[model samples]
Target: MTTTGLLGAALLAGLNVLPVQAAAAPSLPRDGGPAAEVLARQEVLDRLADEITRVPEHERSLVAGYAGHTVDPRHGHLDLYWHGRLPDHVTKVLAAAPTGVTAAVHEASYTLRELRAGRDRLVGAVVRGEAGAVWTSAGPLVDGSALAVGYTPDGGGRHGVATAGEVSARAAAVAGVPVTAVTAAASTAASTRHSDASPWSAGAELTTPGNGWCTSGFGGWRGTTAVLLTASHCGTSGTYRTGAGAVVGTATDSDTGLDTTVIDVNGTPSGKYFDGGWDNGSGYAKRVVGAGRNNVGDLVCASGAMSGIHCSLRITATDVAAEVNGQWRTDLDTATRTDDSTVAVAKGDSGGPVVASVNGGADMQARGIISAGTGNPVVCGSVAAPTTCWDSLRFVPIAPIVSKFGLSLA
Candidate 1:
């Protein structure tokens, strides 16, 4: 387990496939905007994520998982999750590493590959109809180092109780797969209660003719065609609209394979994300510096319609998988708020921009899109110091989407 009590699960999933430079530490603000420590923390994580990706595939695979130090955010090293001894050479490389980032290996029960395969078998059983009327969704939990199979008991009855127990037994039968039960509940999607922008920008909502709302992931251009990035599940047919209800563009190139799409809009996107909603014009004008992967312990933030702007989410797992509308989406990424009090994500937050803030929150790097998150929140404790029950939120990383679509961030 990490110092933050995070679960160590799968590979970087599909996100760590690329190598990129970490953002340089932003200079301290002249007006005391953001703390120097805050800027340093972001830079360290950016460097860490970059260094992790720089490791060769063979060597990197030796790591089952990794997380940042919660107590010391600038510790400049990650706690590696692994089952047994790492090769001497791997240890040496990590120790003598020059990237300003390092890893400390921990003994884990299952390897990343084993855990990933474990969840695959469970999902396969569901698809094959071998585990009927049982699991609603089954996938690997990188942090917990096990497979989570979700089920919703039909009320409180002997038959319902028996079915849940039987499913657990069947899950254990899957060879080489550690099993765990997750309560599955259908969550109501959050909505865009308000928005404001004279012109459309990234993180705005895309409204469908039929009254559907999904967030615009980022603002940019595709060879002079004004375009906006969003979740592919948002549908290829929709009109881009500001929160104030002004039409801006049309949707196209919706690819569920990538879980991303583009919106061909009329005017140029401001190239800014609505960090504080467009109406207030509170945001950072982030440049599409380059594509990067999210690593455990990375301090990240997102802009959604319902949640607006919230941060303090730390990446917990990668190479995650989820079944959306009966179709399994693999190689996704997952994150959870470090402070349980902070909001991780909500429904309709989909397609919102996931960014890493730098330059004292003046700029950012696009990370991914909000895809899915835990459901059935149960409040615990007083409002002043309340705790929420939530697992993790999954995202479709930006690198793969840009690679597949041949688009550039605005």
Candidate 2:
């Protein structure tokens, strides 16, 4: 019914979302870094959870039934894979945490303390005029989660004031099981044994970035070279920095709203991966010894500076909406929705790969860069920051991407 091939599928899987913050990650303590990061992450999420519940039913319904549970205190963050509009949840955030947020809504992250103060102000209004004890009395939605902030319990016995960590632990404990999680991160440490950050494409050592990451997704190859495929939003205008911390190239070309980009990296300092496998990520080379075909239901994966994560897919939808430079244009349409259910993405994961068949399967192929998904949870995992996930995230079909740019893989 749809004109989607192995190459097309990769491009069409729409992977597009602005980052929570453009600021860099702070230096974490080496010994307590892991634990501290996790706890701090929980504190942030706990505050978000409080804020989301304060909005009116119609608005709160945005995050209604989607998954927000599996985020344990260890990970310090909660994530979702959604199937609908990626920007909707952020709108809800603006409503609750108006102060900490900017009206511009550009890419940036927010803190929990800032969220709570704003959340408390609005929640206080939502619950006024009700007769009850201090804990059970009517309060506003501004600090609705405050009911659970410390030990303050509601009169109805539903929820109460608990500490940030306490609320997070409680919510995560009862989340049951989220359908999607970046399960790829769990697997990479086990099988992807080789030092993944070496040798760029063309077998040349790469000029690695301050924080280098790799993934599997190359537009169809030409003769010998395999061209890399990612998101344009990842490059142009300094939105995305390269692995080498250099603005290596612009998005050279991009089909607007498509979330695909073609960056030009040379063979001298390598900058690419071969396929999308979880066990051992593919190696980049200029030779054409491994070109092959792919099929449905393949297990593709990816790697990036944020960390490598991937999963298989059972192709669901095809022929997604596309536009170029704000014009209605169909540049590429090879997006696929795999049933693997891995919300395998975050801020910096963009312009990477949605690879297929790295688990000892068929010839490699690009499923799509990690665009947007319907089921992906909000990375912050807060009640106030209610998350969303659509049925299919996006990717630019590799076939058309390569054709549009006339790129010949080495």
Candidate 3:
């Protein structure tokens, strides 16, 4: 297992308690171009959420089914909602007995009326778990008790992790799981220096030997050092190392249940592929920047061991949850996407980075890490398709995760 998987697996093996929430991923188009497109995607995703809130539960599930394409599939193996999906699917992701686990939707992008009004809510409904209960002009605020960190990012301006009490009741109510208690989660402003990153994309032939078949996530700055990013579960548990298996540094502070970890690799097999995530959906394939706000039409992918379903997961936003290890966690939509893509992530995939490829480059951007969702090989657009696959997947964001531990990439 990678260091992160080893740690989480070991922690659960020991029976110690910790919060968990992982699964995530996507977005849209534009001017300055990548940035504008990201914002536009966010708007589209926001509209979808608005519509999703109005749909009834069953219908929400149906929409969730297709939209869930973005949330499922994790080469890293840390799907915060893995055990929290509709009881039946839960068994598929969770072990016979899981450790810290929780996941539920805290916000809806749309309302039923909105759907009827203009299908505008489709963007939000595509990613939301349930249709919204009530509505207000500025979208409603979620209840505190119902969230991991009490977050609500369904509308426009998506924030990082919500504070301990910032979640609104409406938001919490929409979440599928209980909202009694919550472990620390992402709270940092996801809008950091990464807003203007280059799309570090890659091709089939550019595989580097020592890098391992890993993915990427948001690059951040700890103090002054610029460190590459990925799920804590991606690296060796104890510290950072190189393809040679040599100890380099330690993971800053990983949140197991959250399925997020940062290797300080202050000096590991150091290269230079930017320091953070590059999660962007479709078009242009921009840099993997920003968190808590992903949208439709995004083209994201993860890399890890060749064993599992390691492939490109198009973003969808239905039946989503934002918790870690099963605990309510952050605001990023716990993603699910169609799994028919050729990408196959395996065991070693845990903690592997998921990069958003834009114009294409020598490498990929570090977006989110491999995490599980609810469906098996997510089935999108059409569940009845003879080849419909599962969609239980998750990829935890790096910023919120790091904030929870109060650690730095430095």
For TM-score, the strongest prediction is 1
The residue-level lDDT of candidate 3 at 115 comes to: 24
Sort the candidates on TM-score, descending order.
1, 3, 2
Who wins the lDDT comparison? Answer: 1
- Candidate 1 lands at a TM-score of 0.73
TM-score of each: 0.73, 0.36, 0.38
Cα lDDT of model 1 by residue, 1-410, tens digit: 53221222222121123222344555321112234455455565455545544532112344544311221234554555545544455444444444444444555666666766676776676667663435655655544366766676751221245355666676768736666766665322232524535345566655654576667777676878877877767666767676567776788777775577788877776766766532334443345444566665666776676455656666765665566655666666666666555466655667888877655455777888877665446342211112233435667788777766777767
User: Candidate 3 on 113-192: residue-level lDDT in tens?
Assistant: 22222222322332453343211111111221112222333322243444333333433444433233232222221100
Candidate 2 residue-wise lDDT at 270:
35
lDDT-better candidate, 2 vs 3:
3
Please, what's the RMSD in Å of model 1? 7.7
How many clashes show up per model? 6, 102, 128
lDDT of 2 by residue, 1-410 (tens): 12213222332232112213212232321111122333233334334443434431112324432211112223323222222233445445433432122111211122223223333332242235222211211111111122121113331243433343443343223222111111110001100112323223321111222333322234333344433455554333222233334333223445544555554433322333433222223442222222221122222344333433334332322232222222222212222234333344433344555543321222233444554432234342211112332323344444455445675543
Which ranges in model 2 have alpha carbons more than 4 Å from their true place?
A: 1-228, 237-247, 268-299, 302-304, 322-342, 376-392
